[model samples]
Structure formats: C-alpha cells, structure tokens
Target: MLLNGRNAVVYGGGGSIGGAAARAFAREGARVFLAGRHPEPLQAVAEQIRSAGGLAETALLDALNQQAVNEHADDVASSAGSLDISLNVIQHGDVQGTPMSAMYLEDYLRPVSTAVQTTFITAQAAARHMMEQKSGVILAFGGSGTQEPGQYLGGLITAFEAIEAMRRQLAVELGPYGIRVVTLRSGGIPESLPSDMEGREEIAGAIQAATMLKRAATLEDVGNAAAFAASDMAASITAATINISAGALIDW
Candidate 1:
C-alpha cells in the first residue's frame, strides 16, 4: 500500500490512462475520486474499484470549468479531510494526421488552449488545499518530446510542451509548501489507442520501434508509475519529468 490512507483526485478519470491510474491509486489504499464529464465511464471505473475491494467515488463535471473544478476540490478536501494527490489527464481535443500548413487555426490551437485551461484550473484548485496541508503531489501526464518528421501530430506536441512548462513553474511555486509537481512522460501507450483506430497497427509499431526497449508503454506501466510518483516514497521527487517512455525519450 504505497498510498495508504491517502486521498487522490484524478481529473478525466474515466479515460483509459486516468482509469488505470485511479485503479492503481485505489489498489495502493488511496481513496480515489474520479472526476470527468461522463457519468457512465466514471461509474464503471468506480464499480471496478469497489469490486476489487478498493475505495472510489465518481464526479461528473467538466475539468475546464473553473467554478466546477474548484467546487469539486473543495468538496473532496472537506469530505476526505485531506487532498494528498492530484492528477490531470484530460483530453486536449487534438486533431492529428493533419499537416500544420493545412490545419485550421482553431484545430491547431484547440488542444493547446484546452490543455492549459483544464490543467491550470484543476492544479490551482488542488494547490490551494495542498498548501494548507503543506504536503501533496500534483501529477501531470504527456511530457514533451521530439516529434518525428511527417508525423503530422498537429498541436499535440505543442500542448504537451506547454504543460511541461507549467509543471515546472508550479513545482517551483509550490515547493515551499511541500507540494511536489511532476509529469509522467510517455512515448505512447499502445493499449490506450482505440482498437479500431485508423492505422492503429502502424502507429503502435512506430511507437515500439521508436522506443529503445522496442516496446511502447502499457496502461499498467502508467498506473504503476503514477502510484509510485504520488506516494510518499517519492517525496524527494519533484519539479521533474519521470521518463516512462522506455527509452523512447532521452532526458539528456
């Protein structure tokens, strides 16, 4: 139980990555609060956790809504008595496979704006509580990385880079309060992609080929990494990006 008795709030907890992390957090003895726009998926994850003898709760709300996010954080802290961890994995609405030259302006900026807005709102809400406690972990996903030529990933990389910058700044500001901020950088997770996604095989293969380990990260790997990062064992880790890309991304 790495996170025994901890209370964690996971934005976008209904998604694949978020669900995985939530499950891991619950398994480690943390009472997980899954927040997302959809009720069904959130409830599904919650049910799974309960079935496995773990504690979990679901909240239906938009992560980008500042008021909603703030209220949710307040509610969680009030009920749980402490907010130990915060993780935001909301989708950025990125449009991939379109060259920048031909991409619409809104399409290119959607992810950037969405990522920043939702992350800022959620992190700020968590930071307020964390500062009061003088101890907490704020986790972020999608670390910056080099984009391959012809990849046409649109603004996905840009959005990630923006988040990395924010994470560093948050870490610096929150450090004095004993709040740790870290980003989990992954080359990609094969299982995260939809089974019927266009060019799914090629994309997964490219991801594997790009990784030094010849294997893309799995949902389980992300879950494990997130649990460790959010736990007290990682108290000394902050203002940093945990490389979970299996060599796909070289830090140095």
Candidate 2:
C-alpha cells in the first residue's frame, strides 16, 4: 500500500479520468474524497470504492465555488487528520478544435477564464490544508496545449497553457511547505471521445496511430500515474509535468 494512511481529494470526480484516479487512490490504501458538479457519477465511483473495502466519500460540488471547495477541504482535513493529495480533473467545457478564422474571440477566451479560476480556487483550498500539514501533493491533469500557437483547439490550448503556468508557480510556492505539485500532460484517452463524433472506433484508432507507442493512453495508465505521484514513491519530485502522451507531445 503505497498510500497506506493517506487522504486524497479528487475534483471533477464524475469524469472518466477523475473517477479512475479516485479508485486508484482508494486501492492504494488512501481514503478518497470525490467531488464534482454531479452526484450520480461521483456517487457511483464512491460506491465502487467502498464496495471494494476502501474508504470513500462523495460531494456534489461546483469547482468554481471557492467557499464550498474550501469548506469541503476543511472537512476532509478534519476527518483524515491530514490531506495527502489533491487532484483537479475538472473540465472547462470549452469548444475545442475551432479554426482560428472560425472561432469567436469571446468563445476562445471563455474557457481560458473558467479553467484558470476554477483551478486557482481548488488549488488555493487544497494549499491551505496542505500548508497546515507541511506535507502533501497537488496534482493537475492538463494537456500541454500552450506549447503550440493557437491551432485547432485554440480554446483549450490557451486554457491548458495557463493551467501549466499556474501549476509551476504553485510548485515553487508549495515546495517549501514540503507539498509537491505535479502536472500530467496526456494524449487523447479513449474514454474522452465525444458521443457526437461519428466513427468512434476510427477516431480512437487514429489517435493510437499518432502515438509513438502505437497505442493511445488508457484510463488505467493515467490512474496509475496519478496514484504514483500522490504516493511516497514520488516524494522527491515536485513542480514537474509527467507527460503520459505516449510521445505525442514531444518536440523532437
């Protein structure tokens, strides 16, 4: 049990990646608090964890609400005695892949603003609890978008770029407190394919083809990576972006 007595909080726990991380943490012996805007999926994940004999809790929370987010963190800290890990997998609901000549300025800007603020609020809440313990982990799952100029995903690219920058600064500020901040840059995982997109199989296959490993990233792959970061295994690492893109994002 790498996380044998740890406490983990996962925002956006209703989503595929977030749900996977929550389950992975619980399996590693960490008590997990799953929060998101919806109850059904979060509850489902929590139940699954609990059924497996792991400790779990669920909260229907809007990531943008600073008060609610902080209050939830406080409760988790109080119950668990310390906060070991905080992971934000919240979605920005941004319209991605819009050509530069096609997307409206406000549309591109909206997701950026939303993602930044939610991330800030969640991180701020987590920081307070972690700072008190002087030992914790902060993890964010964000694409390495800003690396390229605005392309098809102008909206999300900008948002993720800002997220990466903010995550780096957080690493610097929180390192002194013995709190590690880490980011995961992922390539497309099959679970995220939109229902509206026709030919899901073909799209998934193409994404895998584009990867250097000739296979796309899996939910378990991400879940395990996140669990590793939150575990004592990554004790010496902080403020780093662990790229799990299967060589998709490399410049070379």
Candidate 3:
C-alpha cells in the first residue's frame, strides 16, 4: 500500500517492462492509467490488473505528440485530482546490432531524436501538473549508458546518456517544488526479450554472465524497483539514477 490512492500514468504501458511497472503500481494501490499507441495490448494489460483487483485504465496515447500528451496529463489531473507518478517506457526506435561504421545516418539519428522528444514532451506535461501539487515522481527508464564498457551500442548509448542528463536538469528545476525525477537502468532483462527473436537464449546467457549476480534482472525486478522509487519510502531519492542491472554496469 505504498502508493495507495496515488494516480500513476505509464507510457508504453502495453510493453513488457511498462506493463510490469503498471501492474506493480496498481498492486501498491495506485490507480494506473495505461497509455500507448496501440489499444489491444493496453486493454489486455488493463484487464489483467482489473482481474487482480487493481485499478487500471487504458488510453490511446502518442507520447511524441506534445498536444495530446499535455491534454492527457491535464485530463488525468482533473479527473483524479492529482498526477502522482509518471513513467515513460516508450520505444525509441533504436536499431541496435548495427556497427556505427556501416550504419546509415538516419538509423543513428532515429533513436536519439525520438528518445529526447518523447521524454521531454511527457515529462514536461506531467511536470506542469506535478508542480501545482507540490509533489510527484517522474520515472524514466534507460539510465546513463555512458559508463557502460562498449562501442557496440552506437546511438542507443547516446540516447540513454541524453535522457540521464535531462533527468538531472529536471530534478534540479523541480526539486524546489517537491517533484522527484528518477531514472531506472537495467543491464538488460532476459524476460523482456521477444519470444521470436533469434539467438534469444545466447543473448540472455551473455547478459547473465556479465552481471555480478550471474543473472540478468527480470521484468519483475524492474517493476518492483519502480514501485519503490515512486513511493514515499524513496522520498529522499531524487535527481538520481537507480541501477537495477544486478551489478552488470557499475554506477559509481
């Protein structure tokens, strides 16, 4: 009941990670609003939450659309009386596995541009309402990727580092207003991989071997971390990035 009666908004709520967070928020007594481009998956997740006696609603939201995102935040605040938590897990269209040397210019720019745009749009929209309330949590995924030992990530790393930078700035600006901005970074969750993906087992094994725990973080782990961060228990945590990578990527 850490988030009892809280109003949480989750972007990309239909996806594995998003759905996990949304369910965790609801389980902790938050009324979750699931938003994404597609309604079928959104509805499916909502139904699951509802079946488990958790409050959930679905919305067709395009996080990249500034106007739509703003209106959605306004509506949620107005209807629920507050916007307690906001998390963005939308796909950044990152074309990974491609070497930068042979990668097209568009492929590299796609993730970088879209990640910054959607993140700013959703965070800004929620911050407006959160400022008025004088307290709220803005959660972001894909924490700082700059420290990761790799050159294979290409533009994906650039996007993650950019978001971490933005999270810091927002935390500084919103801190006085009692608003918290946090980022959750995972070294890569094994269960989050698509079932049809090729070499899935090999990739998952590599991820586990790289982690200090000898296991990749699970989708449930991300959800639990998110719920804790969004709750009052983590009130002292802000302007910080939480490492849920199971020591795969050291934070300091």
Best by TM-score: 1
Decoy 1 TM-score against native: 0.99
Model 2 accuracy (lDDT, Cα): 0.86
Q: lDDT per residue, candidate 3, 15-64, as tens digits?
A: 99999999999999999999999999999999999999999988998999
RMSD of each: 0.7, 2.0, 1.4
Clashes of 3: 0
lDDT of 2 by residue, 38-134 (tens): 8999989999899999999898899899999999999999988988889988888776557868989888888899889998998999899889888
1 versus 3: better lDDT goes to: 1
Name the 10 consecutive residues with the lowest summed lDDT in model 2. 143-152
Candidate 3 deviant stretches above 4 angstroms: 146-151
- Candidate 2: where is the Cα deviation over 4 Å? 145-151, 196-199
Give TM per candidate. Answer: 0.99, 0.93, 0.97
The candidates, ranked best first by TM-score, are 1, 3, 2
Top candidate, metric lDDT:
1
lDDT of 2 at 224: 92
Error of 1 at 207 (Å): 0.4
